[model samples]
Target: MGEYNMMITEFPPGYRFMPTDVELIEHYLTKKVHCQLPFSSLSPLFQHIDANEFYNISPDNLVKNMCVDGGEQYFFIHGDKYFGGERGKSRVVGNGIGYWRCLGEEISIYNSEGDVIGLRVNLKYFSESSSKNNWTMQKYRLTCEYDTSDTEIEEWILGRITKGKRNDYSNYF
Candidate 1:
């Protein structure tokens, strides 16, 4: 028998990775963080979804290396925090030059069984001049017991970045 390499090099043409909020959190994000994804034979394609250093580079640069789907790029990033100005304040800002600010309160993600499975927060990036950039991000983290506290430690988070205007999810139901 001739030697052969059995591996999935790419997804089918025109295949999209668009997953709903719940699926992003409960399936991909959770599985990636827990190392439970059965991707031994598909690690190459699966590895592209990991954006561990998402905060280390500019959004524009990050986009260049991502597989964008419908103008939305999804990746798995480690949740890191720094103490912001003022006492006991911490922020999830990224990028060395610009800063990301929370656009609104974190939204709760519920499964079909009415259980809160995860949380999603929207963020907008602002330059040094305080001008809002076209880049926007939606970060989803798995739900835990300490979700009510701001000091809770998050391990892995799933992020969706869009270059243009933010998409409204009011009709996601």
Candidate 2:
């Protein structure tokens, strides 16, 4: 584990970084958005990538950049807003290759007090070459309570990518 509780160690044998929705919001995304996490903190589970590159690159190429052996790959990316669009209202499309389409309505993540703290938006990647949805991503964003009027700070979100249908979180550490 590293200084910010961002685990940077390679899995010893069977362990993996699989945080629950609350943990993902409170631990990782919260720190990242607040500028408390360092850019050098690299782990097999978590990698940071620019929003433009992340959305523009093909999922196959993105997998090659992953450190995990298999299953889900996590990333910290700036949540890009659509040109002249309201926040969290539009789907983010890629440049000419493929794009991410939302699965359904955003799911809310609540704290122990029953307060909504974050939201999870599920998205699937469709390639222009093939019609199949090969990649799945869960984008996690903090709610208004965490915002401080800084759009830049609020743009950070945690993205989890899976090869196919989402994996069972119980199987991870």
Best by lDDT: 2
TM, every model: 0.65, 0.76
Across 35-80, the per-residue lDDT of candidate 1 in tens digits comes to 6666564343333443436555667777786544337776656554
Residues 1-173 of candidate 2: C-alpha lDDT, one tens digit per residue: 46688754555886656678998988888888888777776454578877887877888888776543347888888755522112334354565677677777778899889999888887777776887766878888877664467665646778888886554667533
Worst 10 residues of 2 by lDDT: 82-91
Instruction: Give the worst 10-residue stretch by lDDT in candidate 1.
Output: 81-90
- Misplaced by over 4 Å in model 1 are 1-15, 38-52, 66-70, 82-96, 129-132, 145-154, 166-173
Checking candidate 1 for backbone clashes, the offending pairs are none
